[model samples]
Target chain A: MLKKGGFVLSAGLVVLLMVALIYQIKNKYYLDILFMTFFWASLAAAWNISGGYAGQFSLGHAAYVGIGAYSTALLYINFHVSPWIGMVVGGLFSALLALFIGVITVKVRGPFYTLITIAVAELLYISAIQLKELTHGSEGVSLPFKPGWVNMTFRERETYVVLALLFVALIYFITKTMERRRIGYYLIAIRENEDAARALGVPVKEMKLLATVLSAFLTAVGGAIYAMYIMFIEPDSVLSFAFSIQPALMSIIGGLGTSLGPLIGSFVLSPLDMFLRESFSHINGLNLLIYGFLLVLFVLFWPEGLWPNAVRVYRKWRSGGVETKS
Target chain B: MLLQLTVSGILLGGIYALIAVGLTLIFGVMRIVNFTHGDLVMLGMYLTYLLYKGFGLDPYISLFIVPLALFLIGVLIQKLVVQRVVGRPHEVQIFATVGLSMMLSNAVLAYFKGDYRSVQTTYSTDTIQIGPVFLGVPQIVAFGISAVITLVLFLFLKFTYTGKAIRATTQNRISATLMGIDVRRVYTMTFAIGSALAGIAAVLLMPLYPTYPSIGEAYLLIAFVVVVLGGLGSIPGALVGALIIGVVETVSAYYLGSGWKQAAYFVIFILVLIMRPQGLFGQRGAEQL
Candidate 1:
């Protein structure tokens, strides 16, 4: 769905991001931000498959993340398994859970679906907290400092940044492949009008389930990466409602239903979030308070999001400053 | 013990019914999910607390003022924020209120600094003993007031012209408009009424639970469950759902443990949604609401 100029611009931006990463290889703060940007991009892109394209708009994605993080951590801590393998196992587990949820929820529409998603996530969160023998409860699980490729743990921040970038690329590739295939259009049709899509002979339920499964799998993998980078997994940190909202927030702000939008959103907002959290640490809730206003303002005025708006501006600028509505 | 648990559960359900009814009424009329609902209840609690502290007004007496103030605030919120996104995309609509919820709860967090506060009244700890079952005085009083308010609301909706207008708008907005009903006015009025109901719930609950900025977060999910279980937009359904949930909660707490009480209701919520999507008292096509 990207245009020629947009493609070139994105390519240029990617190269620039790589160069910056290399230049700031030694700077821990910069590396942290870059790692998080890629991490969020991966999540937003994965979420967009179901939330944006399939129109699932799930607010429970963090459950998958928590699943992946906890699964990876528990397996490594208890069984001495590699996180790379554990993440796949976690992803499969998350996909199974998604299939169950999707089968039940695919028929429900609008806010009801949203409400269920929230409830399911909260259920999992509570379970995580209560299953103290397995999860350590709210005290959280800490991974050992075993810096190895197979472990998916690294001593250097730059290594984690590269891994996070690979995650972004992988999810981005899957998103693009979905967009190019018939399933993408079918999902969009299902999103726009499920009844009509069903009338048109599209497998509405199956497609939704597919989207949910895939979205859950990728989100779980992203969560595993997050666990590796942070080396800590806590219900409050990993399974909080904020975690569920953040990926959707990035996707919405960057622009929904677009491959590039989520990346742009993560790249822009993740740094801003870190910066605000750092500067306003003493103010408690200041960042979230601002985020609340931002969500309202954006939804009301800029509902189409920044990516589409930026493209419009770029096209306008390229057209020799013409004021044409097109 | 079981009887005591059941009595306490029923009393707790009274407060829950008010909150759920307010939420369902708003959804029925406006087709908008008011995510800020829990926060509004929280706001009511804070308002009552402040009134009690500043003016030494009993929470019982502040009840007269809090609901009215909440009604005005609800009207303002509807006109300013909820009005613009009445028929917007689901994401837009959901996020709009979710955003509002965040702002409100966090604003309270920032202002009050996360302190847990509750009103101390003469009846806060007082209880009535009847044949080996003990009932907190505040709980019984709250339940009584809640029942009275629900009855008044029911009468008003059944008999008053404005209430009829609200119901008509809910049943069929296009036809209601065609019939010379001001749908917008009905929406604003319904929203205000919903908030006022939540305010009533807040006042009743102050003696029962501690007040905190995030206190609403605890109740919001339960309200949603009650609304869904009673069938969205069905006031009577909300009442029944709240009672069922309250009983389920208290019984599960007694049996499984307190931490598992929320789990029991949440599981019931998921089962109901998956199995009967329309709820026990809901019409088959209540999904349209």
Candidate 2:
């Protein structure tokens, strides 16, 4: 009961922080950072469903992201459809693709699955680049700037922050709901040991497919928002391996398989990434070097991530009299 | 033209075989897929390039020095980094190697500035024509050297006492250890040998592909596809897989436009993966075993 209360309080505090952030939207840079951070957090959280919960290490998540971005952008550009409607269509399309990939590849466990995902992502990226007439190839596609509710555009940054926050909150609540359900338990069981889970009567393949489809859908939604926010979408920018790596990095660094991990990871890493972009533009690849080194260090030393440690601290404070050992 | 493409594909497959062998060697021995295997090859290429460009040594000659140096580095890395995380969870292994790959590639980028560099050898322009196809002398030389090295390595694994022990360890580490085969030593040696082969492949490929930090990613993806398509932990499988990939890629580039070549190969790669998850040469139940 106490743990549940603490969780609710912590979530409330996060909401309060988000509300405070909206008041600071006068600063466009700060608002942009918040939007990007939440965008990444949403994607990372979505990634954790399949990668962390289901334990399928997919390195090609950018495929779904690209699919969502391009699908919605194309609809908006060509058919004059509202982005709101396009987002749903794009998400479902990406989810279908994920389901297809999951059905074929999930039978193979471990590194083989990872290899297949990488291959699939690479193949998709190459196809997108080659199909220049449809995707605009390397040149990318641009959405016109129109101010309206249906278009999801605003002259001020506050609107974006509110929308992104809503997304983050929706995803967070969905994941929380999932964690309480039988599906989440099945995913965790499969993640721990597929054979054991199968023996326990869990439909491993179906559960994994569900996770992948849901993950793809959420990721696609995030991608759609991102395209709208940036007002431009390109194959290289959307489908690159670097973009695929981001969610993994964020999820792993923040805390895998936990509700708060993606949020924590985004808060910690996104700012550093922004800083690197700002400071090391001239250094070519030094920032990537630092990023890679940090990932290695985190893997070696703190695989449980920062949130677990923070949880311990919070628990200790709540105990009131004596600090408990983590 | 067809005959030429076939010959060139075969020669290119030789180099691919060499690179994939290193990756398979480590997998065969340790049952751990080294994600950084491609980066190690990239490092080998850079080391070979530096030796030639800075010290005025021929790339072929530097091959002897580079592999030995890389072997030592590999041994050290295995002992210090890889060994520490050997028995941990799967995520740890993936993250460690993935992290290592990222670090190595980015470090190279920081140092080399992403320039495409190739060893300017005298034989670079020299080509020999046979029938309809003209083949570069350097590529032919690389093919021959790679074949010779692969043959020698095969002989060593088949004949040498230590080589037999490595193979035994690869098949069953616990049984090998129970039989007093010193599995630790086998792992170290396997890592060194695998890295050494990567080093050799780098030198052989440097004359053709040019050296760049991100070049590893391009080859890494291909090597990974070859490794998977061939079956993990199978050397001969790597060779066959490489040949198939090389032929497919070359043919696609010839028939389809160059732009569609990658797409065509990737389609084939995904189709094969979906159809035959265990690969053509991979032993059934070997993954679980």
Q: State the displacement of the C-alpha of residue A205, model 2, in Å, after optimal TM-score superposition.
A: 1.0
* TM-score of every candidate relative to the true structure: 0.96, 0.95
Expressed as tens digits, the lDDT of each residue in B1-289 for candidate 1 is 9999998999899999999999999998988988899999999999999998999999999899999999999999999899999988898998889888888988899888888999988889998899989999999999899999999999999999999999999889999999999888998999999999999999999887889998887788999999889998899999999998888888999998887788898899999998888887887766634
In terms of DockQ, the best-performing candidate is 1
Q: Kindly provide the TM-score of model 1 when superposed on the true structure, using C-alpha atoms.
A: 0.96
Model 1 residue B216 lDDT score = 82
The TM-score of chain B in candidate 2 is 0.95
Q: Give stretches of model 1 more than 4 Å off.
A: A1-20, A320-326
Q: Candidate 2: deviation at residue A233, Å?
A: 1.9
Q: What lDDT would candidate 2 get against the real structure?
A: 0.84
**Model 2 Cα displacement at B212 (Å)?**
2.1
Candidate closest to the true structure, highest TM-score:
1
